[model samples]
Target: MATRATARPRSIDFNAAELMVKTIKGLTMDAVQKANSGHPGMPMGCADLATVLWTEFLVHDPSDPQWFDRDRFVLSAGHGSMLLYSLLHLTGYDLPMSELQNFRQWGSKTAGHPEYGHTPGVDVTTGPLGSGFAAGVGMALAERFLAARYNKPKHRIIDHMTFGVVSDGDLMEGIAAEAASLAGHLGLGKLIYLYDDNHISIDGATDISFGEDVAKRFEAYGWHVQRIDGHDHPSIREAIASARDDERRPSLICCRTTIAKGSPNKANTSASHGAPLGADEVAATKEAMGWPADPFHVPEDLRYALGEQMPEHAQNREDWDARLIAYREAHPELAAELALLIAGELPSQTFAGFDALLEGFEVGGAIASRKASHKILSKLAANHPTLLGGSADLAGSNGVLLPDTPGQSAAHPEGRNLHFGVREHGMAGVCNGMALHGGVRPFDATFLVFSDFMRGAVRLAALMNLPVVHVLTHDSFWLGEDGPTHQPIEHAMSLRLIPNLYVIRPGDAHETLGAWRLAMERKHGPTALLLTRQNLPTLAESRAEDVARGAYVLLDPAGEGDLDGIFIATGSELALAREAALRLAEQGERIRVVSMPCWEAFAEQDAAYRESVLPPSVGRERHLAVEAGSTLGWERYADHVHGIDHFGASAPAEVLAEKFGFTVEGVIERWAQIR
Candidate 1:
């Protein structure tokens, strides 16, 4: 672990702290009651734990929420968003009281769940239980990597920790389990989670569905585990301090408490889990805790106590600024690179040699897009130091292996390549975390068929508009012998449905280079590159520069009297469309072939640009779409579609292509009927 400057000690007034917890609980209850919808039990139950963290241990400057070195706080149990909202409001973040009052309402920052960019203090958008837990691991991993790269002997510029509040529901999620196992294996010492082990869940007591020893489970996974009383302020502080001191393994502190801790009647029951407490119950609960009965009432003493800590919090940011200046003076070259990364800006010359790299690919020579992607990625990673990623246990197959780069591990925290094992879901979630952390661009690879395993995280990445690259190889059934189980039938179309996600299936080596360029250049939202296992012939007419237009005319009738029909294709099928057009032209049939790599990117193009590729006069009736995957959604552009609507059988690539009508002859046959 990188050495951190010791914080000045401040005396904690337990009485004032108690009042702060009461204030948080009151705000949570009032927000839920106002909305008449939300999970209130969690925030009320975890108020004490949250209070101990945000007020005492959390290293954040609310005045500058985006401070590069501030510790991250993730509420993995996002149903209790009020807990985080209250912390943000109390700690002087820009989330005002009005937003809290309008919780779960339109145009409100306080959404049903914590949204990253929507909320001021939110680090990552998390609502699907285990997604935030997994993303936190990614954030911690990024901190360790950056610390190793930028921190010098006397300068610890990248030092920070990632803390999250997880619930029993978070633990019950399979994605969380996968991420926890990896976090333990990597020995992410800077990651700490406070688990709300409240016996009750929305359905009832957790024991009804979950009975395993969570502490023992974590211990087995190589984490430092501790059990504590959730409401015991002294014990909470002690456990957090111990967690901060442990520099070998990640820590999990299980905080056992009741649901709606201070409620008079609903305190340990399922009744308080989600719905707003009735008016009588709310008053009874506030009176029982000696809190003011008025809704959303924050005591004046609590405000003064938090205000007293503002200067100290602001000083942390000031101290980091000073350290950064000193580090820049001492190490100019490294400091410049660190500054660009912190600003999320790429070097101006990042793609300086891109054209030359594309020129190296032999036109008409056959190569798998996945293999082509590896070559392009190697060049990108060499020029861009912050490009960090790996495969999900399919490094060679997915072509995500970076040459001569060490895999990230405890010993090599600065490694550019990561070995994410076989956890596809965990890999996507971690990449989302890394994107959220900034300073590093993360990419993960797996077979296209396995994208189903990563859909949850992928959706969250799209929702958060995270710039994560998902390299999906074996794009179609042409993967051969793996059978229907491994072939992606609806995966491509399914992924395209995600808003803000660019699903690009490059035609050949040149287009593959363009696909990589687009992925790196896209600063918002995620990109999924669907590559082929079978080799595709590079087209001489394919212009890498034109790829950003999404679709382009690959070939047109040589005579050009009038087009008889147009064939639209993507991925390996583009070559087939071109071949079919050539064969048809030889027989006096005028045909044009269009390469549509990414529908989303093409849709963004101006009407004039799109019209140049697929003329409105041509009409959909004269268009025949060709792809090796599902034919769904092709109707939007083509009246006739040639694609696999059924599962594939175990066979050789050539046999499968012939059987599925994916060859040049198949294209000609399909076009004849359409024309």
Candidate 2:
């Protein structure tokens, strides 16, 4: 203990960070050269910068990649994967050099680029140049929200920065610029970006296509910018240190460096950007860097020498754990909640609070499903420690604010509201990233029409099995004044196409809570909660917990009277379905009306459960499905689907609903056609 307290800074030459860069770069180059593939250039070029950031600057413990306080590192230039792989291997993570040797191989951890959740150290799945940067902004925003909530007088648990190493291609991307602009406006002081100004993209030198001043562009976004010699370890270190000194805006360290730093033949060439340097170039690179000729020869002395200089990350984690343990004893309840949430467990009171919410909604008068979604989400957000989320510049309209007490900001992790601004794409990606982070469950809201912009990220969420709840409001053409551009005619069907995604369009307010409950209960994959812009009646049959089972019979009128056909629907169309059911019942025809909120959730139900809800004996002849938008999947329920196939007309929602054949009269007409 005394030696730990006062000793020769633990047996390393440089810091652990520098060693990480070296090991990664060395192994990266060897693997690339061995396979006669891959671009070793970036790993070689930015090794030192990565070392400083990962070891000294990045507040991470490899053993706990999911640690909330850890800094997030996104290799936005994911093509330069060797850079990330090497770092993960050296940081005492589960990844080792043997795994690095399998780089770019089938089923290997070291893929072409950093893939989210696929690799332990990876934060977001990045292959697209600029999207990762936007994702980073989201991580920083989460940090801000958490910090605002948890960082009390002395227990600062959520304080962490988001530092990413982006290549020239990332900076040149318009999406990256868009994200940076919003990040600047939000005044995210904890976000720091390292711009690897190697000036080489696949086509050739950046001068061929991109020649603008990047620092000026970032400055235009209101970011504090710094230009530094990337290879100068001390200089880069100082720049990073100085950046955190600012407390208002995000900072960017634009580092000017060689693409392939040590590869003698290709060091500064565009050829070094993507393709692997050949045997001769690699050999020449090794010799030029004064490295020995032996293959995979990370000199024993060099290993010890490098190891001596690095920080002891394991020790750091131990200390942090000790501090957290102390925090636990001092603030038992908060600590328990923190521990549970950090362990990806919800608070004990979570389900109970949800129960209370649904009970209250049942007592309250009927309102729009969006209103119920708000009451459900905000109440649970305020009560459940793990429930956390916000909207994309639509918090006011979406009804997603955490009902934080008057004049009281969302000041704790238990608080659920988030303000994601207008960056829908970034908001979705961040929501996915937060789900990937695995402590607090997160959801983001935007108009369903903009789901087009968020579709890619929603797909990634499925790919990663991240359970991000997408609260898509204004689910159909009823989003009046915004016009066709804001109306989502095909968005629901389009989103439904993504495999493993649960798109739940609840019929009424109580069912809305049920959709939310299902979304939270689910751990396997993502759930998109599609809500209506128009007001929805709180149906007498709607029960939150029962509907949480996915699909349930709302009104089985055939048992009450006569038997004929079944009317099926979701969202606002449920009312039309009930009307249709009542009309058939009055006509002495038996009818069963069902509200199927989540297609995927219903699909997940057992065969017996399925048959029980949508019986095999039911009238396929007179079956009717009524919805306001594209009825792509409605064929499963009804032979005739009354939905908007084309863009909606320029008129009020009720008229548009009539035009789209969503009326009970239209439902009757369609039922008669199928009959």
- The candidate scoring highest on lDDT is 1
lDDT of each: 0.91, 0.75
Clashing pairs in 1: none
Worst 10 residues of 2 by lDDT: 1-10
Clash number for each model: 0, 19
Once superposed on the true structure, which residue ranges of model 2 sit more than 4 Å away at CA?
Answer: 1-23, 33-37, 152-158, 290-297, 306-311, 351-366, 385-388, 405-417, 436-439, 559-565, 617-623, 635-639
Clashes of 2: 19
lDDT of 1 at 299: 83
Compare the candidates by TM-score and give the number of the best one: 1
Question: What digit string (tens of lDDT, one per residue) describes model 1 on residues 101-185?
Answer: 9999999999999999988989989889899999999999999999988988888799888999999999999899989999999
Q: After best superposition, candidate 2 residue 193: deviation in angstroms?
A: 1.7
Residue-level lDDT tens digits of model 2 in 8-65: 2222245444444555556767888776678788878898788777655666677777
Residue 278 C-alpha lDDT in model 1: 83
Where does candidate 1 stray beyond 4 Å? 5-10
